[model samples]
Target: MEPAPGLALVVVSPRVAPGLMSRSAWQVVEAASVRLCADADEPLAVAVTDADLPIQVYAAGSPALLARHLVERAADDNVVWLGSADGDEGLSDAIADEVSRLNDPPPVEVVVGSWDVPGARLLDVVAVMDRLRSPGGCPWDAEQTHESLLPYLEEEAGEYAEAVRSGDRAHMAEELGDVLLQVAFHARVAEDHPGQPFDIDDVAGGLVDKLVRRHPHVFADVEVSTPEEVAANWQKIKEEEKARRPGAH
Candidate 1:
C-alpha cells in the first residue's frame, strides 16, 4: 500500500511585506483541514485569520517530533505547515528522516508559497527613503538636501571602513546598511533635481551597465587568466568609455 501524501507548504519572506502570500499558497491553506503555525503574533497567523483558516500553534519540539505531528494529520487529511520568515529547514530535514523510518511513509511535498525578487529588500530601503523625504514625512528627513546629506555619507563610509578593519560581521552589516541608506537617501533627494531627476533604479541601472561593460571577461567572450588581468581590462574599458565622451581630447 502506498503511504499517504503530506505537505509542508512553507511561506517565504511573508514578513518582508506583511501578508505577501501567493494565491496558490492561500488556496492550499484554505483547503487544508489542519493548519499549523509557529506563532500567533507572526505574519503567518495574520494571514491565516485573513484567509479564515483554523490555525493552531505548534508546541516546541524536535524536528522529528514536529514531522510526526504533521504527517499524522496526513493519515486523515491534507496538512499545511506555515513557516517563519527564515523558514524551518530543520523541520523539513526531520520530516525527511522520519518518513524513511516509517513502514509506510507518506509522500512529502515542499511548497514555497511566495518568492522574493533578488535584492528586493534593497528596494524596500528606497521606498522607505522616498517616504521619509516626501511631504508629511519626518521633518528632519524632509528638510535634508543632497548637500546636507554629504557629511552623513562620508561618516557612514568611514564607519563601514572601521567595521571592515574590526572584522566584526554584525557591525559590518550595520555599517553597510548605513552606507546603503545614504545612497538611497541621495537617490530620493535627486528626484528634486530641476535639470535631471533620477531614482534608485537609475542609480542601480548605471551600476549594472558599468559592471557589464567593464567585465567583458564575464559578460562577453573575452578571457582573463588572473585578477590583475581583469583589473587591467576594467581600466582599459573605463578609459575607452571616458574617451567616447564628446568633450574627451
Candidate 2:
C-alpha cells in the first residue's frame, strides 16, 4: 500500500514480516492509541506472553531508527509483537451484553462544514496594476507612485525576517510568500522602462544562467576545488566580458 502522509506507529513481526492478522499484519493505527511507559512511572513490571507477537513500535519522526529497532527486536523473538490488536473477547462480550440492555439516547445536534471561504484566482500582478491604473479603477492603487511605495519592499523583507525568527515553519512559509509578492510588485513597476527585462521570469532566468555558468563542478567539465576558486573564475570571466564591450578603454 502507498505510505500514508502523516505520522504513524507501525507494528511488525520477526523476519521483517507483518505480524499474523486476518488483514494486513502491519496495520496503521493512530499514535494516540499507542502509549509509552516509563520505568519511573511504574515500579512493577509487566511481561508479554506467548499469545503476543514480538512488538515493534516506531514513530514516523525517525523511520530509520524505528526500522533498526524492529529488526533488533525481531532477532530475539519468535513472532513480531504489534499492540493488542485482538482485545479480550470475554471482556468485549460482557460489555456488549450490558450495552444491549441499555436504552438508546437521542442524537446530538451538529452543524456541518464551513461558510467563510469564497474563492481564489490567479492573475499576474502586472495585469492587476494595469487595471488599477485604468480611469475607472481604484484611486488609492492608481494614485501611488514608485517613490511613495519604496518602503513596502523593506517592510515585506522585515516581515520575512520576523517569520524566520519565530521558528514556526508554517508562518515562515506564509511570510516568504509575502516577500515574493513584494518582489513581483517591484518587477511589475520596473517593466514599464524600455530596453529592460524587468519581469520575474527575466530575473529567474538570469539567476539560472549565472548559476549554471558558475557551477562548473555540477554543470560542466571544468573542475573547482573550493567555492573561492569558483568565485575567482566567475570574476575573471565577468572581467573578460566587460573588456570585450565596445565602450571599454
Every model's TM-score: 0.61, 0.39
Give all candidate RMSDs, comma-separated: 7.8, 19.7
Off by over 4 Å in 2: 1-137, 194-197, 225-249
Q: Give lDDT tens digits, candidate 1, residues 41-114.
A: 67877778776677889965777788888877776667778886657668877877877788986667767677
Error of 2 at 137 (Å): 4.5
Number of the top-ranking candidate, with lDDT as the measure: 1
Clashes of each: 0, 7
For candidate 1, what is the lDDT? 0.80
Instruction: Kindly report which residue pairs in candidate 1 clash with one another.
Output: none
By TM-score, the best candidate is 1
In candidate 1, stretches whose alpha carbon ends up further than 4 angstroms from where it belongs are 1-112
State the number of backbone clashes in model 1: 0
CA lDDT of each prediction against the hidden true structure: 0.80, 0.45
